[model samples]
Target: MQFMILLDMTIVNVALPHIQESLGFTEAGLTWVVNGYVLMSGGLLLLGGRSADIFGRRKLLMIGVGLFAVSSVLAGAATSTGMMVAGRIGQGIAEAIAAPASLGLIALLFTDPGERTKALGAWGGITALAGTLGYVISGLLTDMASWRWIFYINIPIALLVLVLIPRMVTESKMVREKGAGLDVAGAITSTTGLFAIVYGLLQAVDHPWGSAAVVLPLGLGVALILAMLIIERRAKDPLIPLRFFANRTRSVINTASLFYMAAFISYTFMLTLFMQQVLEYSPLRTGLSWLPLGLGIGVGIGLGTAFIPKVGVKAVAAVGFAGAGVGLFLTSMIGVETTYLGGILPGMIVFGVFAGASMPAGTNAALHGVTEQDSGLASGVQTTALQVGSALGLAVLVTLALRDAMGEIQQGVDVDVAMTAGYGLALRVGAVLMVVGAVLIAALLERVDTKLRDPVAEMVQHTA
Candidate 1:
């Protein structure tokens, strides 16, 4: 269930052009198909994590999965653009509920250190694999069937999972202090603040930076976020514990993850468009083309998991970031005549390897030394970084692509030339962002392996 939800995010990218043509969407309008889901998912993640802590994790997972299934049906049957966007938003909400709860449940379920490490390794591996393979699956669905089928496919799988969840997964909930209830004020403030910021960023692609559509929402978002912070500080039971940021390693890793994902997200979204729209590859061929990249990521992640306990998280993450930068730089050099085997494939392989290796090490570092009390928040923070980064990345990249496409068209460039120029510029910018992320990680992360024998004990001692 976790893998499927995560995969769906990237899978839809391959069919973006098809969706645009069928729905009669403008470039900016089409972007919301992706951004709508991302914004809601990212914004609600912290709340979802807290909800699982207060309610029951298993129950929330079941509800989230069921909601996702229903939303997928709605998205597949969407006849109008608005309907599709609404369905996408619904899907995001479902994902937001499912993700953090799933992770928290895993932590609660696995008590032994060795068993937990193995379990986490499996989880990381599956996530990396799903991300890589989503392109292939999406491409095949788009080419062989209608783009709607990409969403339709999720329905049966979700149903199967729903049936199995109750039987297989044990029910568990956090032991909160007496009389604790959901933080309604915190939920509203945080969700609205995140939505405003993400919405503003998405609009910046089509609207001028100074336009009211862009500025007002962004300003409101910033203000709401400030209010949320003040509320959190004073609240008896805060949704997001601000103290989690006090740990230098955890704080730095979260920041770095956000920046890194921004680049990675843009690259995947734009690259899928380039292959299908600009390069004009068949869906089957496109799917097959991604195999090497997918396999590479699986291999890279396995190796990183094995090495982390030896060389340490900081060193592994640093190397992974550097490798990712090199891969992104290579991707930026691609041209209209670039061959898949020689040009695109090599870069994909390199990227897959670096990304695969980096995730485990980074996650380990971020969650290291966290106590039981802080585990859910730590999970929420990490996942939030990823989703928010992707949302921000896509918004920025789409905006840049639109600006370049418009400029080229105004300059009387041919349609093909204009489209290629926009995509090319977007890829180049993505590469630069990856390089910047690498620098941030290298400078900010301290070389420390805080995955001690008893993380809770360490945290308690540190507090004392």
Candidate 2:
């Protein structure tokens, strides 16, 4: 289930062109195909997590899987832009409900410290593998069959999850106070605010900042976000407890995660374009090119796991971010004449390794002090930061890159050269952002014991 949800996040990158052709999507409109899933999922994740705590994790997981299967079929058969985007939105909502619940189940089931560490390592490994394989799988499916198969493939996975969840997992939830209720208003305000902001950014791809098309949504979005924050304060059982941010380690990690994911997501999107549009590589070749990155991530995770007990989460994460920043800088140096081995491989390897290493450290930091009752909430918050960052990064960075490309085209630059230049610019900015995150992590992330304990599971028991 985790693999399927995470797979959808990257699989669509390789199939963007095909989807555009089939659905008659404009360049800016194409982002909706990706954002619709991530934005909805990110925005509603808090509610979904809390809902799982209030309802039952197993029940929510089954519901989410069922919805996901239906959404996949909807996406597979779509023939119009609206339909495709709608289908993706449905998938995102389903993911919001399922992902944290699934993680919460793992936390619950693995009570022993040693068993918990192994379970989490295995879970994180699967997530990395799913993200890595998504591109290759999409390429093979899109080239051999059709882009629609990417969506259709989820049906079997969903069916299997639906069947197995009931039999294998027992139901569990947090024990809430008698008067507690779901925070529907908080969810609405947050989700819609995020949507408005993303919509405004997308409009900037073609319209100026001053234009009402851009300004209206941006203004509305900010206001709604503020309203949501205010509402969270007043709600009896807030979607996100404001005091949760009082935990400095969790707070810093989540803040840095936004920047980390923002850079990473935009990097992926822009690199895909660089590979296919500028280099004219076939989708299969482009997919194959990403293999090194996956391998690097695996290696990084292994090294990080081994190092965290010696060096601490702060050191591991800081090193990872710094190394990834350097990798992004190297990647930004690519040009029209550059070959994959000569240019792309080095950066991908460095970025993949460091990026992979940082993930476990961040996850540990975010969930470090959380009690079992808030396990789903903690996981949801971290995932929400990542998903929201993905949407925001892609929207902002991609818009800047396209805007620069358009400017170059006006100056009579060759089309391919202009595109390459724009991509380079975005990557450099992303690299800088990554470096900034590293600095912040080094400065702000609280220091903890360099012990080889399962922080989350043990801490949950300790706090409880």
Candidate 3:
């Protein structure tokens, strides 16, 4: 279930051109095809998480998956930009509901700490693999079949989840709220606030950063988030308990995850554009180029599963971030004449490996000390960070790229070369973001690991 949701997040990237051409979408409007789904999912995740805690996880999972399937059908049939955006919003809402419930259930199913760690590791690995597959599969489908099939593919997967979930998974008991009901006020405020901030930031690509058009929404967004904090503090049943932030480790981990994802997602998006738009690779060839990245991620996950239990989550995560930083830096060195093997492939493998290693470690840190009752909310928080990071990072980095490209275009440079320059700038910035994320982990996450023995590590290594 988790894998499916994450896959949907990026699978459409390779097919965006086809989607835009088919739907007659402007570039600005086209961005929404991706961000609309992300923002909605990120915005509503807190509410969905608590819903899973209050209602049954199994019921919510079924509802979410079913909605996703229906939404896929809608998207696959979409002929207009509005229709595509609407279908994507549906997918977002479904993901918001389903994702946290599934994460909470993982905690519920694995009562033993050792077993729980292994399950979390498996979850992280699978989610990473699925995300990697999305690019590959979407490219293949878009070239050989149609862009629509990228969405149609989700129907069977969602249906399979619906069928297997009831038989394979058991439901967790609802956490009774002490308040009058759901925190409707908090939910409204947080969702709107987050959406506004990301939306406002995206406007920087078009409007001046200092213009009222950008400042008003961004300022309003910050104000609304403050309002949400106040509401959560006063509410009898807060949507997201303020106490979740009390854990220094998890809070910092979640924050770092935001930066980590911002860099990583932007890198992926720009890579796709650089290859297809700049280098003129066919979609099938582009898909094949990503195989090395997929392999690297698989290898890194294997290493991380072994390392996290021994060296600790914080250490592994920090190391992974550093390696990713270097990898992205290498990518920024690409030129018009560079080959895939010489320029992009090595960096892809390097970053892919590190990203794989960080997945389980970061997840473990975010979930650390979360009780079964609040597990859903914690999972939602982590996932929200990821989605928001992707949206925000893509917005900022792409703007940087476009801003530069537009300058060159104004100077009468060829659009393709100008765009390549833009990609280079963004990739470099992404590299810096990775370094910042690494610094944050070192500065903050060191003590997050328990000094005491891990039973899982004991069983694996039989060591000190």
Best by TM-score: 2
Off by over 4 Å in 1: 447-464
lDDT of 2 by residue, 379-424 (tens): 8999899999999998999999999999999999999998899899
lDDT of 2 at 394: 87
TM-score of each: 0.93, 0.95, 0.94
lDDT of 3 by residue, 214-329 (tens): 89989999999999999999998898888889888888888887888888878877788778877998777777787787778878887887897788888888999889888998
Off by over 4 Å in 2: 448-464
Model 3, position 395, has a per-residue lDDT of: 76
For model 1, residues 314-421, the per-residue Cα lDDT tens digits are 777878877877787788666677788877988888987987788787877777777665556677778888888888777777778778888888889876667667
Model 3 TM-score, all chains together: 0.94
lDDT values, one for every candidate: 0.79, 0.88, 0.83
Candidate 1 TM-score, true structure as reference: 0.93
Instruction: Tell me the TM-score of model 2.
Output: 0.95
Error of 3 at 404 (Å): 1.4
